[model samples]
Target: MTDHSLYVLLRKLEDAKIPFTLARDRPDTIRVTMHLVGERTEIDVFDDGHMEVSRFCGAEDIVGDEALVDRLIQENRD
Candidate 1:
């Protein structure tokens, strides 16, 4: 089975009630788009664990630091 870690990560967004979608495709190449509080953006994560973050708006308005975002994105299965 494919690792459920990413799917699990996506599920956390559900409790937050953030809208998202999962498709059957190569993950690293998959494009994810999101709008957080009217800010438009997209993020594509690479195989090396690096992400390309783009924001049409609202990047500057993010609260806290990168560490917070990292913590939120990490899905702990233990």
Candidate 2:
């Protein structure tokens, strides 16, 4: 993202009181990661004004009974 966009994003995050960490910082790109709810979100902002976003759902956030596993297996076989 552009510098302005990056600044805006950081400002919004701060305003909302969300916590984020700088995972990587380089001359070409900056990577930020944050956990929200039950998932982790990653954002990469490049000097070229491009951005990428990714989300990860941890296994610990998953909740289900034994029947849920069977249902998942059945669905996967379809």
Best by TM-score: 2
Query: Among all windows of ten consecutive residues in candidate 2, which has the lowest summed lDDT?
Result: 1-10
1-78: candidate 2 lDDT, tens digit per residue: 545666777888899999988756678878878768778898887876678999997666448899999999999994
Runs off by more than 4 Å, candidate 2: 1-3, 61-78
What's the TM-score of every candidate structure?
0.44, 0.63
What are the RMSD figures for all models against the true structure?
14.4, 7.8
Which regions of candidate 1 are displaced past 4 Å?
A: 1-8, 21-28, 58-78
Q: What is residue 59's positional error in candidate 2, in angstroms?
A: 3.8
Residue pairs clashing, model 2: none
